[model samples]
Target: MSEVRSEEEKAAEARRGPRRGPGPGGHAMGSGEKASDFRGTIKRLVGLLRPERALVTIAIVLGTISVVLGAVGPKVLGWATDWIFAGIIGKQLPAGVSKDQLVASLRAQGDNQKADLLSGIGHLVPGQGINFTEVGRICLLVLALYAVASLLSWLMSYLLTGSINRVIYGLRRDVEHKLGRLPLSYFDRQPRGELLSRVTNDIDNVAQSLQQTLSQLLTAALTVVAMLIMMVTVSPLLSLIAVLTIPVSIAITAVIGKRSQALFKEQWKSTGELNAIVEETFTGHELVKVFGRRAETEAEFARKNDQLVEAGFGAQFISGLIMPMMGLVGNLNYVLVCVVGGLRVTGGSMSLGDVQAFIQYSRQFTQPISQVASMANLLQSGAASAERVFEVLDAGEQVPDPATPGRLGGRTEGRVAFEDVSFSYSPDKPLIEGLDLVVEPGHTVAIVGPTGAGKTTLVNLLMRFYEIDAGRITLDGVDIRDLTRHELRDQVGMVLQDTWLFNGTIRDNIAYGRPGASEEDIRQAATSAYVDRFVHSLPDGYDTVVDGDGGSLSAGEKQLLTIARAFLSEPSLLILDEATSSVDTRTELLIQKAMTDLRTDRTSFVIAHRLSTIRDADTIVVMEDGRIVEQGSHDQLVDAGGAYARLYRAQFAGAAVDIEAQDGMASVS
Candidate 1:
């Protein structure tokens, strides 16, 4: 176990995620972004669009059709108005009998054919009079067209919501998969709050904005183009007047977009920071209460809350200005068009029908621009959220898995070796250096150290949670770097000092690492770990939910569940960190017996304070200040009179009653 490798090579094989932009200690951690960041965000959004191609196609087609329906209604109404004026007031009815004769003729036709006759006249027969009766009929027809348009628009909203959510669901699934495959060190730099923000809040923002905001923007843009062409066709002078309003409105939108985008980015960051504070404080609630730091916690939370408020206000302040500004400009453009078109009407340069159609077209022009302006806040919010999501996607992945992962089909031998292994969580801070060790198959080795003494770090390296700075680790004489992470971890079992049981049943937690375990296997494993008896005593037995850190169970019971988990895996190599430390005298003795049964025929690395547990270990490596200070068997170390001897004697001098209890670490559990 002494093959040395350089820092670069170690980092390449390490399970820790790649470090990007420099962070504290010159290690890269994502912090925040600059204003120019949104450009990259837009590019990323374009990529996300490819997956939703079908939805996009449907939205585009339906949106255009929906807008056409809207424009057609007003134009139809204007045409019917012309027919009414000629038939009722102008006496210009198309050389037919008086208005009364036309009404009587229409009345003689059944209501069914009133529609048919109206349709016939709508075909523009030259000699036919469009009497008041026909004009009134057409007005009802215009309303019917608009009713259908409104229904289609509502349908489009639902389709847009579905399209966006489907994309979001796909993204969330990918992220969950990535999290399980990502290295442990990836979690080290990332506070749980920040990662949660990415998985939950940021992703939700992407979906929500796509549903209500982005789709509307797309609709508005398409509508504006369609309506502008309609306006120019109706009358170029009026179209020109309406088009002038677009540039200034867009410029205002741009300015507000920048300010709100920045504010929104800050808001997301602040949200992560605030979440981190909550998680940290709540997790360490015991320590905080003991120290009476409630006021301090409150002050910190208030500060974060205040910052969040300021950011929200700033973003809202800018984006909120767009709609009123759009309205004022649109209103001004409408008045101007009316004045110019009215002059043309009086001069007989344009027909009254043309002037009326121009007015309708002008409103259509402003409608899209105004609608787009209204969605500005949500657009900026989406951009801010997009940048956050991309940050994770762009952090670079853990070392790529092999094309065909090499699997050891059978139970792997437990032989282990470490070769000149050195490591550092960050470049400037080294945790272990040139560590070398060899444990033959089925040997139990105990590692001892003070706080931060790197004993846990040793187990971390063996598990490939973080890559060693130099050298390599191996199992059965094969370098672990060449092994698939999943394959390597499958043969190894770890029971952390702090056992984590997900929101699941006790039986489920026990069988988590070995899902195919039968109920008998679970019970036998728990029995050997001394947990079966306790479980049998509970009202629900193994079926009970272990929620809130298994608060329902005692510390000893929780540790036993973890031990059962490790046993169920039947791991070739086991790392138990202070396994029996958190138990009463009786519980510790029971655990000791359970541990003895599990240790035979398995290579185990243990970190425990009770020297008695290691008395039978094949080897004992004692650490002080991050270095191994002693190495030998338990008896040999007791005789050496070094750090191990001092610690041993100190514990040995305690009453045998207290030594047997060995329950000091229970509260920590």
Candidate 2:
């Protein structure tokens, strides 16, 4: 019994954590954890895009065409510049003088440099002014190229948006499905707020990051490549200068990105922890106030908020360095290109028009690099969120149902039998061992025990909420595991100590037990469970609205509603775990009467700490240390003077003293 209590205490402590807080010593949960595999997480994120691969491929093609056309525009515009310059110089020279004759005269006049400079302008018509027709044609051609590029770029963005949204939609759906498949134990270990962060906040961040970065990064990459090729075609020297900045830019990105990746991971982890704290605080706000721990709770929230702030600041600040550093490198490359191209043009080896185009190519090349660098922080943040989401998706699921499930045959008799069952929450601490019990159809078995005597665990095992480590539990001669979970659970109805009601009308909440149940049947169950008494006082009667917390309803009233819900189910087997714990004396009496009527011809298992409630049970089983120590009618156990007798004596003795005090006070008055 000591071991059982100790194990139960440990489990409770795990759920509550230290000081009833989010983590050890009230720290954030998993705050120190880091992503184990950054590259692997990125690969998995890319895999999510695989379903829209065809759309993505088309988008990529369009982006490439857009970038290529944009890149070619500068080189084509260079032709117009050359033509304008040629006409300007030609208008200054003597008309009727051929370009060769002028160059020869200049060389003969001992001006070889001038002659060579004039020799390179092949399109120059000596003595003619600028040609408006040719320049206008070139301008129109450049305009057309830019217009087409813009249209293609817009189409590419549209395609990417569609693909990204579809992928995110599927991701959210998978997360929802994954949650359904997870074992109860997983939820026991995880904080509700932290899990919500992963499902909502983290997934939203992933979607936003993908949406903001995917198309931009693709366009930036192709722009860099196309621009480089155009630069090389115009002037190899300038292209080399631009290319040299690549290594430096990569170095900057690598160094800053490595540090920011860790920070981003910390930022998201802290975000989840902070969310957990807020959720826990809000969910238990009344309890926190009742205990007067508002200051302490606020202090904890502040501490977590501080951690998140520090992490977010560090992540953004470090990533922000990439843009300016790349810009500096780009400017230096630009200066080098300008100086070298100027010297080459003066020496008649390169034309001014080509130099002008090369400069534009150089600028275009660096712009994409800068753009990619600027998005590093978003990419890292998204990757961190994706890793967190993948953790949930990759979590081990509960044991699956049988492929070919066994049937209970027609009309289940609710003959539940535990055959040499053994189970434990932990391997080293056995809670129940070789436990055998059988309840026939139409029998009401009441279970009584101390707080940690495996009473509820037994019911949980029977429901297959937690599978037994050994042996089989059967219903109607068929092993429960052989039946599908849904099939097995459908035959059972349970009313727990804690009541749950969703935000809906009273009638809707009751009808939740048996969907599509007729309105008349719902009211009949509510009347039988005694919920109709108070519900009739309300203006809306069964149409009155209530939330999951049973807003404005008294505890006893909420408990009655849950009871009414169970009555509507009409299960073959019923399990009531402290069903009357929350009610007053009058309500309790009414519920006992209703339960007696409801138990007719149906097997019922009642777990209770209240000895008075189960005195008339068909069989009272007293449990100690996970084993049945006494089994008989209440009078039979009392006569035997066993564990049950002592419990009965202690309880009634306390009650008798309270009554005597009241009588004495009445006499004195």
Candidate 3:
């Protein structure tokens, strides 16, 4: 009798579904440890730019020159302001000690010829108001200097753009190459979405930060240093006041940046988590719909999205305070310098022009300090991204291909042996320990067992997808590990239950097994697998495009295509992993007929859940708890009434009941 679900139970299921939280794909990303070696990460990131040293150096030189020119422009403008004041005031130069000081200040501004020329002219034009001719030349010189600085700034930007592009291009390429070398085990522990985010999103963030910060780094440093010296040269009193803000601003930035840096890392991780949820949710859309889980799925998405929003807000808000705080400190210092400089000018300790230049230098000094403070966030984010990329590059690779790889020459006899082989997915728990198995050439070995009986592990070891912890698996008496993976796997064909077909025509997917196969060869293989039954009915026949993993085809039709692929490969050893378990009766019969035809001279290992399918197998190896408990022909196993007999009888009774139900439904209809 069926038990009825309560209203509350039904509502609970409607609200929560089977999975109310993140699925298997949304595992927390990263090692969750802070980056201890920030300097090392920076050094390694800079090392990637080593190839473009010459271009980067040119950019640095140009940037430094532009910053120096910009810094000096304000001082020159101050001199101009003083000259304008003097010209308007009908210069009967403020005499005595002030006269000596004014001349000395002019000479100290540099360009002795220009200063001496202006000083001699000023005496000649005393009480005559101003030297218009000399003023125009000074103004034009200042304008030309600024023009050259502007030109160099543009050129620097151009050079840095080229250099950054080349460096980032190589970085992306290295990341891609690293993915190929990473071991399958590395992928097992990490979510696919997180790895993808590192490759696409993290590296992109690094590139953008470098583009903005790398070009300005030299300019900011040079500006700060030059401005500091100029400030001290103008008047050490004001210089001291302006310099006081540097340490204070740095302290504030450090505190705020430290808080935001952690938030940025979390933001990136939350982004990956969100992406994982989307990937897993959409990939299993069919399953979600079948179980009426749309509401629960949306709830899960909302939870992940909210996490992303919170992380983003924290990171941006904390980092956002840096520029404003630094600006406030700088503005306060500016007002202090103004008051002190004005008082010194009135007391005649500093000339009007010198006081003006000191004010300009004070402003210049604080600009770079603010820029550096703000750059703290950029540098930290870039460093975090670099560390992520480097982690992938540093991950352990598959045991390097054999130094001296062995080969499987000509046609192999398919003699596979697992001699006392011990293996485990992890060291803490062992799956198969000291197991022994041997299959002679041209034999059909059916592996029958309950789920989790290490049925797939045996094939995984045989194919060397995983290395055995102890003992050795041999193909034709040669250790499979001795041969290159390509050389060993080339002769083995697999047809798993999940058919993998790209978005291409049927011919292309079938020909994937043999890239060099001819049209005739494909047709012959398709005919052998009975794939032509459906292909010929299509409008475009073999050319019909398969989209969304062959969504248009039935499960049985996809299986036939995979079988055709295997047939075309003409492999000596075939591993059929539950290949026909999910098909209907007619499709199963067709697949069985195709398998009988294809297994004539080839060695095959068939993994099956239904006992009746393996009745004709040459030998049945029944497994229980990762150990083989019974081995014999079907009749022998039934006669013995062991694990295999019990499994066979249960499947038989189930099949009979299913047939009875189908007949009753047909009668009622």
Query: Which candidate has the top score in TM-score?
Result: 2
Clashing pairs in 1: 1-418, 1-419, 2-419, 5-471, 422-469
Query: lDDT, candidate 1, residue 177?
Result: 78
Q: Considering only N, C-alpha and C atoms within 3 Å, which residue pairs clash in candidate 3?
A: none
Q: Residue 240 deviation, candidate 2, in Å?
A: 1.7
Best by lDDT: 2
State the displacement of the C-alpha of residue 547, model 2, in Å, after optimal TM-score superposition.
Answer: 1.6
Task: List model 3 lDDT by residue over 1-669, tens digit each.
Answer: 001112222232333223223343334455436654567888988888889889888887888788778777777766676666567643654433443465577678865553443453223333445667766777887798789888998898899889888988998998888877665546655666677778888899899889888777767788888888888888888888988998898799879988888877777777766776777677777878888888887887798789889988988888889999999998899889889877676554665677777777777778877887788778777877777778888888877679998878877999888899987765765667888888889888999877667787788677766678999988899899898878888888888866778888999989988999999999999999889988999889999999756868987889889889999999999888888866786567667778988887888999877644577789899887568899999889989998988988877656746645654665576
**Cα error of candidate 2 at position 262, Å:** 1.2
Q: What is the lDDT for 125 in model 1?
A: 34
- State every prediction's TM-score relative to the real structure: 0.86, 0.93, 0.86
Model 1 segments beyond 4 Å from truth? 1-30, 88-130, 140-155, 624-626, 650-669
Tens digits of lDDT, candidate 1, 1-669: 111122232343243345332121111223665554777776677577677778778877777787888777767787776675444433433454544455456567755343333332322332454576767787888888888777777777777777777777777887787777676656655766677777788888877777777667767877788778878777888888899998999898888887788888888878877776776677777777788887887787788879889998988888899999999999999899999987776554655666787788788788878888888888788778878887776665667667765566668788899888888776766667887888989999998866667777777778776667789898887777778877888888877666677888999999986988999999999889988788888889889888858868987788889899989988899888887767877677667778888988999998877765787799999876457889899889988889888888787546445654554444444
* lDDT values for all models: 0.75, 0.85, 0.77
Tens digit of per-residue lDDT, candidate 2, span 492-538? 88888767789999999999889999989999999999999999898
